[model samples]
Target: MTPNAREMSESIHEQMPRLLTELAAVVGTTNVLTKPSQQQSYVQGALEAVTDATVAVVIPHSLVALWRVINICAAFDVIIIAQAANTGLTGAQLRMEIMTGR
Candidate 1:
C-alpha cells in the first residue's frame, strides 16, 4: 500500500506552504486549485467519486511546468496522483484522504 502523508514524514506540514507557492508559480495560481469543490472533479473515476484528499489539484499546461511540479512534490515529500481528463474507470487516479499537510 502507498503510505499517506502521516506515514511519510512530519516535515511535510512545514514544507507544504512553500511547496504550494512554488507549484502555483510554476503552473500559475489559477491552475493550482486548493478548494474541495475545485478538487472534487479532478478525483473522480468513471464509476465513483473519491473524496477530495489532495491539498491542491495542480494543472500544468506545459511539459516544463509538469516537470517542475514533479520536482517540487519530491522536494516536499508530497504524494502525487496524476490525472488525465478524469476518464479512468478503475480508480487509478482517485486519490484517497491520505495526506494531511496541515
Candidate 2:
C-alpha cells in the first residue's frame, strides 16, 4: 500500500540528513540551499505566497548536474518541481512541495 502522509513525512525526516549530504556531493555544497532564509527567494511566489515545505533548493549548474539531481531525488522517492528563472504566471511553484516525501 502507498504510505500515508504522516508515514511519508517521518520517513523523509529520517532520510533528509543523508539525502542532503549526498545531494550536496553531487551538485556541490554551494548549490544546495537548506536554510529557509537562503531558500526563500527561490520559492517565493509572484502574489507573495511562500511555500515553506521545501527540503532544499538545489541549483544545478549544468545539464549533468541537473540529471544527477533528478536521479538522486528519484532514488529517495522525493518529488521535484522545475521552475524557470523568472516565470510563475500560474503560481505553479506555489503548488506542490518539492523534494517533499509526500
Candidate 3:
C-alpha cells in the first residue's frame, strides 16, 4: 500500500475500539458488526471480482443514527461505503474498504 494508505490503516486499527464504541452509542452494539461472517452480506456485491474489505458494517435504523454515523466517520476520516438493499449490480456500493453502513 501507499505510505498514506498504510498510515491510515494503522490509525484505523488503533482507533477501532473507540470508534466502534462511539458508533454503538449512536446506534446500538448489536447493530455494529465487525465479524466477517456478519458483514458478508453488506460487503458482497453482484460482481464476483469485487472483494470484501470493510472494517465494519454499521446498521443504523433511523435517519438520525445514520447522520450521526456519517459525522463520526468524517471525524475519523474513515471511508464510507453506503449500501441499500444490497442489490447494486455494478458494485458501486462496495467500493471502499473501510466503513459500510445502511
lDDT tens digits, residue span 25-78, model 1: 899899999988887777665568445466888999989889999999887867
- TM-scores for all candidates: the values are 0.75, 0.83, 0.78
- Candidate 1 displacement at residue 18 in angstroms: 0.6
lDDT of each: 0.74, 0.80, 0.78
**What ranking emerges by TM-score with the best candidate at the front?**
2, 3, 1
TM-score of 1: 0.75
> What TM-score quantifies how close candidate 3 is to the native fold?
0.78
lDDT of 2 at 57: 89
Q: Which sections of candidate 2 miss by over 4 Å?
A: 95-101
lDDT of 1: 0.74
Candidate 2 clash pair list: none
Q: What is the C-alpha RMSD of each candidate to the true structure, in Å?
A: 4.8, 3.2, 5.0
- Each prediction's total of clashing residue pairs, residues at least 3 apart in sequence or on different chains, is 0, 0, 0
